[model samples]
Target: MLYLICSVCLFSQSTGGIGIRATESRGAVISPVTAAEPKPELSSDRAILSPRDEYSSGGNAKADRGTVGHILHFSDVHLNISTSRNDSESAAIPTVYGKDAPITLLVSALAYAKKVLPKPDMFLFTGDSVVRGNMTEEYLAEVVEKNVKTMAKYYATSDSNKMKDVTTVVGNADTNPGYRMNLTDPTTEENPQIALIAGTWQDSLSKADLDLFKRRGYLAYALDDTLTVLTLNTLPYSPSHEPNTSDVLDPFGQFAWLNASLAALQSAGQSCFIVGHIPPVISSFGGSPMWNETYIRTYKKIVGQYSGIIKAQLFGHVHSIEFRLPLSCSLGAQFQRAGVLGDDAIEDKADLVPLFMTGAISPIFSSNPAFMVWDYDVTTHDLLDFTVHGGNISSTSGTVDWQPLFKASQEYGVSTLKASEIVNFVKRAETDAKLLEEYYFNSKAQSRLQSDCQDATCQAEWLCSLYWFSTVRDYDACVAFTTASKSNTTTSTTSTIQ
Candidate 1:
């Protein structure tokens, strides 16, 4: 069984030294920047810090100059087109919990985003546009095209009437026979699955990117002169991938390409956001590694090498909102040995790369359908803040009512959505029950499916998951520590009662 563990030493919070850290890298200093304008307050029952308070807080440094860009991020639509086509007139078809999203819900979600969210400079879709099931390749292509066109229509700029190019990563369910992708070389023998998606996304991808996608199943899009978004095809790395490609060391040569791309970006003095469908971490739900061990190791090495230039690593296969705090294996072991605690433990923030996974728009797993809008510093590409908008499917009014669930910076009391600040939030939450509960609620997108995480086992799992464990052994060590800590706490309480 998979388990998450939090050591007793990891529970203390230090009031001092708890803000974003500027790091010196390659003879240059990289500092966190905040949005020039404050985030608009959205109505919510939970208390939120005012925009004025957030800017004045010592944690976030407001940018004096630089554009603030908004990005709309959506993932795992899982549109069940067949169900919608068959039950066209029935409102009940859209509200069912255990099934993939019907067409009505998908359209409503996109339309709602367009109406409510700020106009985005860029849009992102992290794969799984089609539902998981056996179907002809023709039908599969049709569903994917429908999803693509629908997104294009909603996100099209008013002046140009053309949709902004969407940065996308291929999800496991996007291909036929979910989790299966032909291992043949794309240059020699075309993978029909790859070809289908490339053709469907022609309008959403540049000609160069389309050709690259046809050949390599991945591409990088330049957001500006200084920033790029690298969308990875993570299907081949997943442990559950079909056709048993375990013998293939570097499937589709993606690792080599990735390493080379990041190297070039680093040399060019440009930063990037790495986006993919599946994240390389121990799954909180399954309590197992999501990617093959070999792949995870190589990926982590590449990320560590370019940690300075990589702004964020975004993924969405879990269909839940969560983050992984990056730490080198050696550093994690060192911390574990010394029982490192407090926000001051991490001295160099560059060693930490922020890994965030957004919640899904599909209610298939009983998680409320959700999407997010991110405010980022255009010049530095630092994530300033983000608001998660979720729709409650169990609304008594018989319709999903979408609203702002929470804004990360305001809700978590962080200045910027940088690694250091998030690490501080985690440390503080360890000792604050109220803060931890708020995180638990947001993790599930405020869905009815979420249960109270009052037990030691559940709390430990959630806390430990925030720290990256490169291998199962590393994860097990943390688990053991947490288990022992819980045992000791229980014994102390029992002795007090006696």
Candidate 2:
């Protein structure tokens, strides 16, 4: 198990500081200037605060500014095309919010991303490349190929000489077309072998990653000396994606592999970012139970063990900009509840794992289609901020226009993205009429930024719907937290509402 302890700590009403020190780097920083108004020519590009200004602690007066790398993160681009089986003009998922775009609209969104956003050092896709969950093997192959080719086209170099390498993981839809519960079963009946699809993933992933995926459906890659990327194949863990038979081979042993990979990075003094399609949510915002109890327990254990080293956990498939907040209990408490680790083994370590839910590029069920740009300091692996680019998809109009939404720093009023900050933002928003109103209006895609919330009760439910708190007790705790916060505005009790 992973453990870290800081003998000294400072606890605040709104936030708590675990005595983790920030590492300093002497990199020369050139402050980036921002225009007073967004560039009209490229509305999709928003001026954001540079890391030097955003993360400056009241330290040295004249130290050089820091430089950091950026990541282009997007997922669930459910590309729909006419097929022999289905002649659907657009791919729309069944949901109160899901309303997706066809191929042309998707192309326009990608074009805008290419022209407006900063050239990223790395590109990440959390999966779901195809629109239809069920399709023939031939159709599935074609869809994956097209999805990879299209992304390659947009992120390619200006000279068109080199294509930026992409890091990706398998979504439920990517394994076999349509919804087949027999993914774990090969001997029972006729089933599309996942190996066939896994073979096709090589074009999108690195050579080493391709090998790892072929061997065990998961892989890890180091972005630089500072960041290690871990990709988990969560398809098997999802019952909706892979149901029954229990024959799916765990050749590489996902749990053991993850532990080993994370241990290696920790030993090397490197932080990490984990990418996956299905997040470990016991119950979804839609009130549907997703993961099996066993899987949830194991997943939480891994997260608990390495919570300190992981910089961020990025996932998609929920099709919204959601976040998983930190839990209040120490690892020991969590394990004691599970009856895994005893009270004697309890280490009162603070876990700060933040799971960022990236919205879908496909607007299928949702009114807005979106993508994210994660901005963080490379030296410290601190996630400073991120920007969401979303577009309005109209059935009548043939074209789609994309623009930037608010920045995390500007909206949340916090330079660092932490669980406490997010919790406080929700707590305050529940009581403050303006903040509550804005929360609902902005939760929608940039294209659908209108107030749908009728009252505070509705707004509170809408906000709570974004996270999977695991147990009924946890959910009730959040409701109580929000309710209590309304009465005592000055109380600074630490929240465990995940």
Candidate 3:
């Protein structure tokens, strides 16, 4: 295996094994590090991005053979430019409100990502930059333009809160429907995609992205080859059961061009990394599903056509850390299980493809608030390794002894709830759920419950039951559990996306 030297900065310690997981990626397989086990709980989702080819009706014509090494990404900012923000820490539900903190939080996290990681070669902010997509063209234009403009001056910056260079995408929130870059949220929305291509944001010299590159906090190498990133304005709403003509550019368009691009890039000894807002498809969770069966098939066909050249995928939409496991994934599989399609495929290529989510930047709960790093070896034009740094936004405002979200990421081994460390945690969540249930004692509730508490009549017993349930869904369960019996519907009225 060839090792490429990529660094966010001119300086970086080797990630090669004997100490961290880098060793495994390099060669040596070390035993999993054991720690005070956390309560075993249900799992969460991960996301990824891709672009359409010449076949789509929308513009994103199939890209040429292009690969940019080492890209760092963050998404679903819901920056709360105003006071409103994305909602509570519940993936099962939507939340919207005035957090009054996400703004500062996102800013600080961006600073931290720059301060700690090898200054990235390129920084990508995936999407949902604002709290809501529905706004006046003026509000949309002002918000997107102003914020994007300021981003260069401050994001991932720190000359005591300075700014840095960043490349951005037009997330669904960044535009009106049909690829429209709201001149201010236009009343007459034209084909948005074409509008953006023609907008001032695209001017190459120092428009917005340029001034950012001049910042000193972090740096990136401009690949000789044009690296293409595709941002899809997926849909207006999460309509159940398949998308419509309004969704894609053209049937012969997006996917078709995608295949051709992969072929072209590979033929040129180049690689392609897809970056978008929604994951293209995901697990059963639906709503802008990340990667579904159709996606998997299409992806494999395209990558296979290109001779397996995609190196790493950095994304953020979902707040937690999740990697889309390879198809037919069974529980209790190794990290590479999802990376490799099968044993034969593993034999074909020893490397595991990158599918990383940059966690959240906003101070919203659930996410520990963080950014990511991409150490690309300029000489080899290949990414050497990647790591995630957890952080918080509050430090900017005041001084509190706070640590990043988790001491450790990558929850290993399928948790059985029978594990000693998890038993109490599960019970605790269930107990909270019980208390939540009784709060209403009479309204609508979360229906995902697997079992009901038999001793619910006893307040003590009910408390324990609710506690057990709380561990899995966070407050969504609380809000849902209470809904059945309570008149108060305000528990979780905020939409996480606004």
Per-model clash counts, in order, read 0, 17, 82
TM accuracy, model 1 = 0.81
TM-score list, all predictions: 0.81, 0.73, 0.49
Higher-ranked by TM-score: 2 or 3: 2
Predicted structure with the largest lDDT when compared to the true one: 1
Off by over 4 Å in 3: 1-70, 83-102, 154-166, 176-190, 193-200, 203-222, 225-243, 246-252, 284-288, 291-300, 328-354, 363-365, 376-384, 392-498
Segments in model 1 whose C-alpha atoms lie over 4 Å from true places:
1-41, 44-66, 83-92, 156-163, 328-350, 395-397, 490-498
Ranking by TM-score: 1, 2, 3
State the lDDT of candidate 2 residue by residue for 113-220, as single tens digits: 776543666678888888755577788767766776677776743343322345356677775644343333222222344455665665555565454455455656
The parts of candidate 2 lying over 4 Å away from their true place are 1-45, 48-65, 84-99, 156-164, 177-193, 203-208, 245-252, 282-284, 329-350, 447-451, 454-457, 462-468, 476-498
Candidate with top TM-score is: 1
> What lDDT tens digits, residue by residue, belong to model 3 across residues 311-423?
54555555544443221111112213323223332211212243445555543433344455444434334443233444322333431122222211122211111222222
Q: Rate the local accuracy (lDDT) of all candidates.
A: 0.68, 0.56, 0.35
- Model 3 per-residue lDDT at 246: 32
Better of 2 and 3 by lDDT: 2
Question: Least lDDT summed over 10 consecutive residues: which range in candidate 3?
Answer: 22-31
